[model samples]
Target: MKIPGLSFSLKRAVGITSAKQKIARATGIPTTKQGLERKIGGAILNAVIGRKRKK
Candidate 1:
């Protein structure tokens, strides 16, 4: 998501669909599919927020 090296393509691939399954499909990171969704949301949110805050 927002983490460094995270790509827009990756996020888009995950999309707004099922975060868990999408995250798992996008990233091979090993974790509970459930947690991965939150992780993706948090990471992406953080990045977006960080950017906005900077503005």
Candidate 2:
């Protein structure tokens, strides 16, 4: 699944617990079972804006 507002890799970076509880507890994204897929999508967006481009 795609935890909204956070990417899979970013989630792992913050904490690789994988458990929804830990993800929420650490990142405080939210524990609700909703459009979590957005996580990666959100992360991707953030990275695009925030992360530096590699060349």
Clashes of each: 0, 8
- Please give the range of 10 consecutive residues that has the lowest summed lDDT in model 1: 46-55
Q: lDDT for model 2, please.
A: 0.67
Over 4 Å off in model 1, which ranges?
1-30, 51-55
| Model 1 Cα RMSD, 1 decimal | 14.6
TM-score versus the correct structure, for each prediction? 0.36, 0.28
The residue pairs found clashing in candidate 2 are 2-36, 2-37, 3-36, 3-39, 4-36, 4-38, 4-39, 6-39
> How high a TM-score does candidate 1 get?
0.36
Q: lDDT by residue for model 2 over 1-55, one digit each (tens)? A: 7777975467666664467776787885766656466566677877789974443
Candidate 2's C-alpha runs over 4 A off are: 1-34, 51-55
What's every prediction's RMSD, in angstroms? 14.6, 14.8
Backbone clash pairs for candidate 1 read none
Q: Give the TM-score of candidate 2.
A: 0.28
Please tell me which predicted candidate would have the highest TM-score against the true structure. Answer: 1
